[model samples]
Target chain A: MNIKVLFFGILEEIASTHEIIFSDIHDIKALEKILNNQFPDLTRYKYLISVNHEIVKNNALLKDKDEIALLPPFAGG
Target chain B: MNSKFLVSGAIQLEIVTKSIASHSNKLNIGAHSVFLGQVRNDVINRKKVRAIDYSCYQEMADKQFQKIKDMIFNKYNDLTCMHIKHSVGQVKAGEISLFVFVSSGHRIQAFKACEETVNLIKDEVPIWGKELFDDNTYNWKENK
Candidate 1:
């Protein structure tokens, strides 16, 4: 299953890119581990994970073509 | 024209004026509330802030705007109309970045809806602002 991952705010700066594709990732926890291993700085800051535009409080199961986003603390007015 | 949610640059005074004038003919709207958010010029580490470069997750932002508008209207059924516009690109310090307009039959409803809309947008919107300093440095803004 191909999954699309998105990075926003400071997370985007740490990831060095806005998006990436992952294959074989079964859940958010697994995705986190892989991303942490690849981009160690990403683990330093707190962020929220959203699966298919919905914020997930816990590990969420990922499906094919699912879009995942890592959101930093929002700074809007 | 840009979408209803995101404006490409600073919210123009003319647009705000037009928005208010457009509702003038509606005899039922006895009250109109307007909220404007301006970019602050701050000195961080002795560097002055030049502008704010705003960005967001567009697809999700649109969804959140719709949700907020629907909820606000449902709660204040007497509201005649509501409009929201937020800046997306570089907005200089001292310029308007956010605008919320609400019109209702009574003063209470318009005031309440406008305040709630501004607060909710600040918290729930997926927008991010990078504070660009005059000394070629930057930091992220923290909403208070």
Candidate 2:
């Protein structure tokens, strides 16, 4: 399955504001490992992953065309 | 009672002037509390901030703001109306980032409601801004 990854904050500096396709990821943790390996600089940033607008923990099932967003902590008033 | 609110990414401030005026007139409100959050040129370690890039999880931020408004309405007795506006995208130093307006039958409730709403937005909304500095360095404000 292909998953879309979104970036924000300094992460956006390292990775452009576009989604990249990852083929055949088994779980969220595995995807995280793949991303960290691909972009080692991301390991230093604090972020949260949301699958289809809902925050998920563990290896939640992902389907094609699912919108996944990576959010850095907010800093607005 | 009516609540006219707006949530958007555009730079223009939201206004519910007609609703506010009508409500205040009906309630005979005598006081209005307004808080405006303007972009500042100062950052930590004496970095001079030049601009701010604001972004938000729009769906969640809108819901959160509406919830905060409802909560304030329930907690305060004399509030006639309230409004909140937040800017997205690049905002220069000295530009207004947020504007909160509240009118009440008395001064106390208006002040309390304004304070509560601003604090709630800072604490709960999923809006993030990156500070661009004169040195061309940028930092994201992390929640503590």
Candidate 3:
């Protein structure tokens, strides 16, 4: 399974890419570990995971071509 | 629906006026509540903010905006219409960044719906802001 993860706001600056693909990722937890290891600076900020446009708190399983997004705290009014 | 939720440059004053004018035929709407968010030139850590650069995950943001509209309309049955606009790219201080308008048959429902909608938008939207300072320093704005 390949997961397409997007980084937004400051997370994009930390990750240095707008989007990244993780191959054969088992679940969201595993993906987070990989992201933390890849971009240690991203660990400092708080963010949420949105799978296919909805925020998910639990360890949601990833599927092939799942569009995952790393969103920082919202600031819209 | 896409027209109602906008992510564009600074909102024009004419658009606001036109929106209000367009609602004249809706006799059922007795009240309207509006909320406008402007960029402030606040000094933070000795740096004065010059502008705000906004960005968002557009596909997700569009969906979230629609969901919010549906939720608010369902919760406030008397609500007649809801219009939301948010800025993208650079918006200078004193410029309009966000505009939310809600109309209803009564004043109370309009006020409540508008307030709740603004709060929900600030919390749920994936939009992000980069606060640019006069001294070339920058900070990411976090919702409080």
For residues B56-140, write the lDDT of model 3, one tens digit per residue: 8888888888999999999999999999898888899999998999999999999999999989989888898989998777999
Q: What is the C-alpha lDDT profile of model 2 across B1-144, one tens digit per residue?
A: 021233343334334454455565464788888887888787678888888878777766677788889999999989877878787778888877788888888999998899989989887777788888888888886655
For model 1, the superposed segments whose C-alpha errors exceed 4 Å read: none
| Residue-level lDDT for B84 in candidate 3 | 88
Candidate 1, CAPRI quality class derived from DockQ: high
lDDT of 1 by residue, B107-126 (tens): 99999999999999988889
Query: Considering only the true interface residues, what is the Cα RMSD of candidate 3 after superposition?
Result: 0.7
Query: CA shift at A13, candidate 1, in angstroms?
Result: 0.9
At residue B48, give the lDDT of candidate 3.
91
**Candidate 3 chain A vs. true chain A: TM-score?**
0.96
Q: Which of the predicted structures, 1 or 3, would earn the higher lDDT when compared with the native?
A: 1
**Each prediction's DockQ?**
0.85, 0.51, 0.90
Q: Which should have the higher DockQ, number 1 or number 2?
A: 1
Q: For candidate 1, list the clashing residue pairs, or say none.
A: none
Which candidate number maximizes TM-score? 1
Q: List the residue pairs that clash in candidate 2.
A: none
Fnat, one value per model: 0.73, 0.69, 0.92
Candidate 1 on A1-77: residue-level lDDT in tens?
Answer: 99999999999999999999999999999999999999999878988888988889998899999999999988887
